[model samples]
Target chain A: MSGGSGTRNTNTEPWGSFDDHLIQGSGAAVIDMENMDDTSGSSFEDMGEMHQRMKEEEEVTAEAAATDDDTHDDGEFLGMKGLKGQLGRQVADEVWQAGKRQASRAFNLYANIDILRPYFDVEPVQVRSRLIESLIPVRMINFPQKIAGELYGPLMLVFTLVAILLHGMKTSDTVIREGTLMGTAIGTCFGYWLGVSSFIYFLAYLVNAQITMLQMLSLLGYGLFGHCVVLLITYNIHFHFLFYVLWLLIGGLSTLRMVAALLSRTVGQTPRLLLCGTLSLLHMLFLLYLHFNYHKIVEGLLDSLDGPHMAPMQRVARDVAELTLNASVRSLGVTLRAQ
Target chain B: PDWFHWTRTSFTEASRPFAGLSDVSISEDIPVEGDISVPVGSSRRDEEFSTLDEPVKETILRDLRAVGNKFIHVLYPKRSSALLRDWDLWGPLLLCVTLALLLQGGAADNDDQGGPQFAEVFVIVWFGSIIITLNSKLLGGTISFFQSLCVLGYCIMPLTVAMIVCRLVLLGSSGTVSFAVRLIVVTASFGWSTFASTAFLADSQPPNRKALVVYPVFLFYFVIGWMVLTFSPSQ
Candidate 1:
């Protein structure tokens, strides 16, 4: 095909001006032999290129084997530049060095499978154990070692909690839109997660506490397992008195989990106490928000967040609703006893 | 001539039930063009020009037609990205604003009443679409960012309709029958929105992780549908 094209090219006259490349026109037979020689020369070049690539591959494998021995010692950030060979070199003070190390670590960690694996590679057993450990509320001694922080479990928990709350709210006689409620529930969960985590992280930074933002996020995410339990219990239990009891018991437990998670990272007694109290108050406020909003207990409290104050009659109506709810429970118990 | 042919065919297709006859007429019309070729000569002369040379009114009208075509596509979703390729945000914006306005009216009756504010609904719709689009991108979806957003936003039309229906139902009476009616509307629209979005987006997603992309899309529409379902005018 090339020889035919070469002959055609030599025979054909230029469509436009012929002054530009008149010297290059040659006999078709000579051009065809040159094309064959060029093809043979290219084959030799290909062989050389293949040999070079094989040599490069061997070097890469040798380097990999060398790095394999130091895997445990250097950890995942072994190849990171600023972190390695910093024994004697001092570009700046320790604080600056620390920042540099962090920056380098951050810069180095792009599309890294190892760094992202823990967030997504969650097992059911890992999640179950984390939830069980979260149920304990506080673990001062082996706190860091106990529950592994993961994103997948926490993300699923958020979605599951949203679904459950939406279903639970819909089944009940709430006047609020479930679609908007779902959005709000999602906003509340994620907004609460991100907002509270950042707040605690900020507080921890203020107190010179030792914790990373991811660590704080992971801890708080696991803490949501307890919140799910509390919401689930309050959702199912159905009696107002039992609701409050479960709310206090389980909600308080979840609050303690958050508090302890944050508290353990703080250095001093004062910071610990402050974080504990603040986290507890925040968790309790969230519980109150969830109860009033989801349980159809009082639209007044939910409304008062962004809506106008309850009318005088509306407050009375709320009271009446509460009384009716209790009365229905009593009548149900009596009917059951008679049966 | 190509542009004229495209517009003519599109116009014919737009007119329901006449599509087959118009297609047959198109084949016949070309031979007729050969006989009396004045318009064909003019079009051939202008063939080198692009849409940039088109009049502003024509451009706007064409875009409007495109938006309307997308709405029709959403109304009767099919597994074809042909309509979605010419993506626009106008339809989504209109639907988002209408839905938000409906929600704002229901929640914000009193000035002091802090309910689902207009801005809140606006943010949720836009922000949720963006987040879902970002998720699709992260999951190796072949679709562009705005294309995903356009699909997600355009799909909200059903939920917005459901919202309107719910608002109307709430107006007549806030009774069990009304609640049931709203539930049915919201659920149907939710399914429609999900189905329509997936129809458009499923082809662009990685085959193995298609569900990962669809899940967020489902949740986004579901949240909007839930908002529509649960809306009660704060008295």
Candidate 2:
């Protein structure tokens, strides 16, 4: 503590201001911890809890002294000053920024659809190599990674909306009242993604998963891109039954696998599976719900694009589907009567 | 460096013109047939079922067993240690062919395209694998381009199972039962492929960039898996 004061007194670099701020911050935190009584949502208590957790993991506590490991930069900020007791969060912040940029590059490459992978790799960096191309729809799975924020999320959001608009325009007679489809598409896409990511975050927290909300948010955001494509395919195509099944399996596995991997060390298997199962089921339901009410929701928003644009044969196929559904329902009703 | 040398040699060998285009016996006694065509990108180390120079009948037998092991890995993906013991491309090439046929059959009733178009499937697989291989190379993946392709090809085993299930489900049932079966198959296979592919392709990348490569690799298989799973008769 005396050393901290001496270092503060001798401060000379640009980081000195942040150092002073951190000193004040830590000082206030220590005071708060000592003075506060039991209070709901008490951050002081939370800090103690986090600190206790950190201490429980010996490697993490040891890592506190070693700034070499980058993964530990996230999760918890000990509020402890630098090893010298003088270095503030500026150093940590710089490390964090570097990590974020590296993350952004990877995320950007995977998220950006227009980014072409060259025939041969000239760049020495691996991140640069991840850009190799194929016309396969498989790359579509990586579309959701765009949710890593910055321009990633917004860019895909626009792409998804445009896809919706294109499909809607091609299929619908008059409902393409320019901005309405765009508005609804944006609303639904954002609403579903934000909701799902937050929901996963909440579930992860409940399971005591060693994850941050932003991290969970980003994971879900990336995963949601695949879900949107499934929806778009369902909307544009004559039948989405196969696509629905595909989404459920792939979507569930992807989400669960990703979430499980992220918090693998923090959360146990049973609870982890439970959380993933729930999230997967909820997403499946969301896709099904999206499919069931697709027309009702989008077509309900009446505009110049609302008239019938489906071909006569397409209408026949729709009727056939309705007929099968009716027949199945009737068969169930008959079985009930017999019982 | 030897790895690159092998890669360069294979590319040169692949581009070389063979003398006779006739279906000649591949026995060692017939040395002229040794210069026959091979799958593009397949290296000397990539001798799937049989190398041209190796004893043909014996190599074929060995390859059959290797394929069995690889296929068995599909059923028991957790036995990765044993499964990946002998990696080969024939299994994956065969897998792509089977998948293409399955897709064609699924989309058969819909007058969009008829029969299994081998070229399209080949082009698509080649293109996708090249992209993934390039990424793996850049990410410092130890697996060779053909090796990664082969592994990825074998990883599609689950998807093949899923596709078969999808076709069967679509044929015999509808609604909840169909959805339930498909859900189980797809989830299981997707998890399998994702786990299997990632396990096969894991590298010494920094944790962050590992995800950068791993996630895309995951998606690459996932997208391919989805195509295989969802390609069924139009409802």
Highest-scoring model, TM-score: 1
Runs of candidate 1 with Cα error greater than 4 angstroms are: A1-211, A232-238, A248-339, B1-49, B52-57, B111-116, B138-142, B167-174, B202-215, B232-235
TM-score of chain B of 1: 0.74
Cα deviation of A163, candidate 2, in Å: 11
Local lDDT at A283 for model 2? 62
- Chain A TM-score of model 1 comes to 0.55
lDDT of 1 by residue, B164-206 (tens): 8888888899977897898888999999999999988887765
User: Which ranges in model 2 have alpha carbons more than 4 Å from their true place?
Assistant: A1-339, B1-56, B78-87, B107-112, B115-124
- Candidate lDDT (C-alpha), each: 0.62, 0.51
Model 1 is docked with a DockQ of: 0.04
Candidate 1's error at A155, in angstroms? 5.9
Listed models, DockQ each:
0.04, 0.01
What interface Cα RMSD is found for model 2?
Answer: 28.4
List the lowest-lDDT window of 10 residues for candidate 2 chain B. Answer: B12-21
DockQ score for candidate 2: 0.01
Give per-residue CA lDDT, model 1, range A1-339, as digits (tens).
221121211112222112111332332221221122111112233345334445545555565575455554555554674464543222333456456445444543222333554455444455567777766766672344333555655665676577557655653544453345556667768888889989988888888766787777777777677678776665544557766787778777767776766666666789877777777788777766776554443354465664675453122222222323322145665666577
